[model samples]
Structure formats: C-alpha cells, structure tokens
Target: MSETGKDEKKTKKKGKGLLVKAIVGLGLVGSGGGAAFGMMQAGIIGGEHEKEDNEPKLVRKGEEDPYAPASKDKETEGLGEVHGEGGSEYRTSYYSFTEDFTSNLAHSDALIQVSLAASTRRDGRVLLWTKKHELAIRSAILGVLADTPEEDVYALAGKERLQKRLTVAINKVLTEREGFGGIDNVYFKSFIIQ
Candidate 1:
C-alpha cells in the first residue's frame, strides 16, 4: 500500500475509536444522573418537608388534643344539639361490670372487688383520668384496707385516689386492645374487700 493511504487509514481508525469512547462515557454519566434524580424525587434521602408556614400545626402527642378542623366550616355551623352558647352535644354511656372477678383476682393474686363505671367520649375515645394502673390501684386500696383493719367496705380518705387509679388501669387495658378508642373516667359503684 502507498504511504499516504496507510497514514489516512490509521487516522480514520483512531477517530472512530475516540467517538465510540465518548458515546459510552456519555451513556454512563446520563444513567447515573437519572438514577440519582429518581431517588431524590421518591424522597429516599431528603428529610421531611414542612407544610405551608401559615397553617396551624396540630400537636398530636398529648392529652389535650386540638380538634381536627372541619373541611367546610360553614357546613358545620348550627348543625347539632347545642348545650351552652357554642358547646356541642356530648354523648356518654356506661358499660356494666359483668365479667367474673374470680378469674381476674386469681390472675392478679390480690384480694379486692372493684366495680367501675366507664365514661366514654362522644367519639368513642376513652381517656383514663390518671396514670395509675389497675393492679397498683387494687393493691393500694387493699393496703389501705389492711391498715384500717376495721370495716370490709367503707368510704375512706383515699377513695378518690383509688378511683383515679382504677380508671387508669381500665384505660390501659382498653387502649392496649385492638379497636379500643379510650376511657374518659372511672366511677366506683361499689367496693368490697374481705
């Protein structure tokens, strides 16, 4: 082959190799960028984005929960039973104590008969009035009664405290169960310790 022809062929091959390399590099860069962009859009890496600043933030972690705002405020106006000026109607019911206390007493290994009245909210949510648990409540009352050593059943100074503890215990049980809303308060209809 002639020298000029051989030189021309060598230059053409080099140009083709460089073009292929450039195309492959571009494809690799584009694929990486696209994957990163997709991940960002899917929110896999970014922190929680804040809502609009003007909206009222509802604190959902406490006992005094703010009511969820109505979708349309005008539609809810003058709708249901009004108690005072702006008070809404509150529905409440009593769930009687029908379960056998023998089994519970055996399980708890405590000597106490506690009858409670559960006050339910309108939305069926139950909130215990205090933080005291049921077993602790029964034990406290039993302790008090044991110390007195006078009457099997009587109104004591710690009656209110006992009631609050019982309420908390009932609420703890209810809240632990599935589909349990909450317990409002617990009223002692009767109490007997022997």
Candidate 2:
C-alpha cells in the first residue's frame, strides 16, 4: 500500500467521526427543546396559562366569589332556590313568553288576549325548552283560551282553573318537545276578555 493511501484513509475516518458527532449533538438539542416544550404544556415547568379546572369552585355563604360576574349582586344569588321532597336543594327560574296570544272564545262572540310566563324549580333547561318550543306552546295556549267560556274568564275560581289548565298545556308541550316537563306554574301577566 502506498503511504498516500493510508494517510487518506486516516483523514476520512476522522472526518466521518466529526460528522457523526455533529449529527448526534443536533439531535440531542432538538429533542431537549421538544421535551422542554412538553413539560411547559403539562405545567410542570414555566407556563402560566395551562389550567385543568374549567368550572369555578362553589362559593359558600358570606364568602367572597372571585369569579362571579361583575353585574350580578351577591345578595340575589339564592333567590331562585328550592328544596326538594327529599330535602335536596335546587334552583328555580322563569321564562316569559314574549308574544301574547289573542283568540275568539268558544261558543261566544267574545275575544280574549293573554300574556303569560312560566316558572320551574328544576334548572335553566326548562326555560331553554320553553323558548325553543314557544310556537307550539302559543298554539296550545290559544286553543285553551278559545275553548274557555266567557263566564270562566269573569269568575275568580274559573280564572284560576283556566290558569292551571294553561300550565298543564304548557307542560304537555314541553314534555312532547323536550322530553321533560319541569314547569311549576304558568302565570298570567295580562288577561283581557271583550
């Protein structure tokens, strides 16, 4: 073998060793950076915004609530509370039907108009259902009012009974539409017969 060939072989081996070391170093640096990013995302490192909790913790009486909306007053917090038959606490809420219904009375020349609102001690879902099914509820209410006799609107007892029937009709519509009837009552915001 010539001396030049051996010298070239040694030089090539040293160059290859340096190239391998450079590649391994770059790989180590890239993996280390990726691991640091993952650790920050998992909140084991320096990231401040990663949070596991979505809902605020329940605030007890007289204690301050940091996450409460600025417009909501603390004193009005439990106004819609209800106690169940088994003594569990629940919330009550109301939903007002925005449009009023007018219908001609059954078997008479009288015309009637009524503005209504419904309430439930269950949850906000009842209110949501009421809004979603308002058209059907309005139809059912008109039917009830049309079937009402002129005498019924004039008498207190009969008016109360009609209110109950209206409530039942509303609950029926809700049950059919949303598969739940949690409305406790239907209240007459305005009632007129002429």
Candidate 3:
C-alpha cells in the first residue's frame, strides 16, 4: 500500500471508532434516563406522583370533611356544621373563645375588652388545632390587642385592620404549632373600651 493510502485508511478507522464510541455513550445515557422515568412511574423510586400533601385542604360548602372534629355541642350531636347554598364556595367554621380578652391599648392607659371568634375555610383539623392550642393563640391575640393603638379600636377601618392583625397572629400561632395556618378571619363577638 502507498504511504498516503495507508495513512488515509488509518484515519478512516479512527473516525469510525470515534463515531461508535459517541453512539454508545448516547445510548447509555438515553437508557439510563428511560429507566429512571420508568422507576418513578412504577413507584419504585422517586415520589413525584406519590408525594403526599400534608397541608390542610379547603372544604367546599356541604361537602364532607374526613378530618372534621366531632361536634362538641350536645344540641348538634351527630349533626354536622350546616352550610347555606348561596354564599362562598367554601364553608366557614367558627371557633369562639371561651373567655374574653382584656388588655391595655398601646400608648394609652385605656383598657379594651373583646370576645373573639376565629373562622377557617379549611377542614376541621384547623378548628381542632385551635381548640388544642387555645392558650397559645389567646396569648398571641392578646399581644396583638395590647400592641394596637388606642385610636384604632374606635374607627371602623382601624377595627378592620385590627381584625386582620388578630387573624394573622392566630394563624401564626397555629402554623408554628401544626405546620399549617388556616385561620381566614377573626371576628369580634363583643368589643368594649374603658
């Protein structure tokens, strides 16, 4: 064979070898990816589909709540919370504190007394949690009330703002305790200032 022809043949063989290596490498990678995908789909490996959502779910009006706490009210025993047809898409459950909160207003000596109730659109776990952690939640709410300016308690807008703050405070306590804060609003059952 001529020298140039020999060199050309060697170069061709090397190129073919390189092409084969690249094809095999790609095939291996592709097969690995396919196997991983199959394992995930079969629940043998990754949990992309099996990842359980531990968070509380919203309860639709009139729908059953698997996690709902049993009614403590003797009058409503075995009769679950009733929902009306024509309002919010989700049901609202209220938790009224057994005692009223009394605290001094911020920057003033005036005292404020308020009976509070909290509402949640989530399942009854929230209500159960609130009842379980009432002391912590009550402490948080009292802190919020004590921090509120004296002027805020008198005006409608200020009262609304206070409601929001109280709601956030309650939810914060719940979240810290239960990993989820589900309180949607805080309602004032009674308000008094002295």
Candidate 4:
C-alpha cells in the first residue's frame, strides 16, 4: 500500500475505535440513569410505607374491654380521691386561695383564684394536694403578676405565657417544699382585671 493510503487507513481505524468507546460509555451512563429513575418510580428509594402489622395492637385484658367505655364499677376516681371496698370512695381535704393584687404598671386590680387538690401518701406524711398547692402557687402567680402588665394579661399570648409561668413556678415550689408532689395544673377559673 502507498504511504499516504496507509496513513489514511490508520486514521480511519483510530476514529472508529474512539467512536465505539464513546458509544459504550454513553450506553453505560444511560443504563445507570435509567436504573436510578426506575428505583425512584418503584418507591424503592426515598419512600416510606407504614405496615398495618407494625401498628400498636390494643389487647383487652381482664374483664375490661380496652376499646370499650369504662363500666360503672370501673369508673375512674378524681385526683385526691380513692375508691374503697363495697364501691365507696373517699377524698382528702384540698387547699386553695383567692387574692386581689394591684398591678403596678396599669394600676389595675386583678383578682386571681387558685384551687389545688392534695393527698397524703401511704406513709402517713402530709402532702400538698392540688387544693393546698394553691397557697404556694399564689406566691408564684404573684411573682409573674408583679412582672406582667395588666394589658398584657388580657392578650391571648400573654395568657398562655402566664399559664406556663404558673406551671413552672408551682412545680418549683412543690419540688422545693414537698420534694416531689406536683401541682396537677394552675387554672384561672375566674380572672378579672379592673
């Protein structure tokens, strides 16, 4: 073969080899992309399924139905009250307080009433019931009241903050005084700011 013809032949072969390699590389990339897309479509990737068997099962034990309403004999007793034999129940005395405090900023009179229900443990130790915690809760309420403006108390956000503050304060007093007794909650059963 002539030198020029030979050179031309070699160049054509090299071009064909490069084209074949590029086609193979493109095919591999396309296949990988297709597999990833297929996995996503089939929900095998980045998807979650909640199985019915994985859910919590409610089991009925004893004579009580877990799903059914409480029977008359199995009625729940209120806090500080205990059920006795023969279907009788007893409640300990509860402590509570009501006070009127004047706001320094708004110069308004605020009436706050707190109720607590307390109980004694089996060890014969006197425990502050929710009713009794009212006194200690009063101190905490006064603390927050002393800092809150009268207008703010009327606002929705302010009321929420006040409730949270009262909960914290009551819990703090219960922790400090009785060691572990907690106030069920502080409710503004009646609130009036004049």
- For this target, which candidate reaches the highest lDDT against the unseen true structure? 3
- The residue pairs in collision within model 4 are 95-131, 95-132, 116-130, 116-131, 117-129, 117-130, 117-131, 118-129, 118-130
Clashes of each: 3, 0, 0, 9
Model 1 C-alpha lDDT per residue in residues 31-76, reported as the tens digit of each score: 9778867776776656454443332222222223233223424423
What are the models' TM-scores? 0.36, 0.55, 0.74, 0.38
Highest-TM-score candidate? 3
Model 2 bad stretches (over 4 Å): 1-90
Q: Determine which window of 10 residues in candidate 2 has minimal summed lDDT.
A: 75-84
Candidate 1: the clashing residue pairs are 126-182, 126-183, 127-183
- Following a full C-alpha superposition, what root-mean-square deviation does model 2 have from the true structure? 9.8
Please rank every candidate by lDDT, starting with the best.
Answer: 3, 2, 4, 1
Give the clash count for model 3: 0
Model 3 root mean square deviation, Cα atoms = 5.4
Tens digits of per-residue lDDT for model 4 on 103-183?
443355654433333332221122223334556656666777677767777799887777676667766876676665434
Better of 1 and 3 by TM-score: 3
Q: Against the correct fold, how does model 1 do in TM-score?
A: 0.36
Candidate with more favorable, higher lDDT: 3 or 4: 3
* Clashing pairs in model 2, backbone N/Cα/C closer than 3 A: none
Q: Considering summed lDDT, which 10 consecutive residues are worst modelled in model 1?
A: 123-132
Q: Give per-residue CA lDDT, model 2, range 57-162, as digits (tens).
A: 3333334434332343443332232333443143335566777889998899999988887767554456556766778988899999989999899999989999
